[model samples]
Target: MAKMVTKSILMPAALAAALDAEARDKKISLSELARAALSDRINLAAIESRLIARLDAQDEAMAKIIALVSSLEAVDEPEGGVTQ
Candidate 1:
């Protein structure tokens, strides 16, 4: 089991009320709900970061591919004095 430490956070009253209601509805303690929510949010952030990085890498690769294709097309073009 992981060691747990206590932490405090401040939030708007409305948000706190919502969290309380959710905890009641789920039949869970407020601390447990908050811990689970925080864990889920952290995980989601990590996934989003990885997704953004992948998209950036893909964008770079596409740009390189487009440049290569353009160069090839330029090479394939006939001189201005000729047409086909």
Candidate 2:
């Protein structure tokens, strides 16, 4: 198990009230609710980062393919509009 330390955070009064209401409705302690929410947000951010990286890689690959095809077409065309 990891060592646990308690930390305090400040939020807007309205947001705090909402969090309290949600915790009460869910029948969980405020700490538990906050911890779960924080964990979920962190996980979601990691997933989003991985997705962005993959999309960037795919974009680079598509650009390369497009450039290669364009070069090939240029090479295949003759100056006199004649077919080989």
Candidate 3:
């Protein structure tokens, strides 16, 4: 098991009141609420990072496809401008 450590943080009075109100509204202790909030934020950041990486990969793939398409030469017209 990991050891738990206690730390203190200072916030503006208005923010502190808001956090306290939220914890009370949820019927949880302030410590628990803060922990949950921090965990949620960390999870959100990880998700955002993965989304960005996937988007970048897609962009690279599309760029390659565009380059391949642009490199191809146009087909010549059929003789007499008509096909049999």
Q: What are the models' TM-scores? A: 0.48, 0.47, 0.40
* Model 2, position 44: C-alpha lDDT score: 34
List, residue by residue over 1-84, the lDDT tens digit for candidate 3. 111111112123434565676678779998887688787832434444554565456667867887777655223445465456
TM-score of 2: 0.47
lDDT per residue (tens digit) for residues 13-80 in model 1: 43456567767877889888768778783243444455456545666786799999988888888878
Clashing pairs in 3: none
Please count the clashing residue pairs in each candidate, in the order shown: 0, 0, 0
lDDT of 1: 0.59
Cα RMSDs of all predictions? Answer: 14.8, 15.0, 16.6
Q: After superposing candidate 3 on the true structure, give the runs of residues whose Cα lies further than 4 Å from its correct spot.
A: 1-42, 74-84
By lDDT rank, best first, the candidates go: 2, 1, 3
In model 2, what is the error at residue 57, expressed in angstroms?
Answer: 0.3
Residues 1-84 of candidate 2 have per-residue lDDT tens digits of: 111111112123434565676678779988887687787732434444554565456667867999999989888889776585
**Candidate 2: worst 10 consecutive residues by lDDT?**
1-10
Candidate scoring better on TM-score of 1 and 2: 1
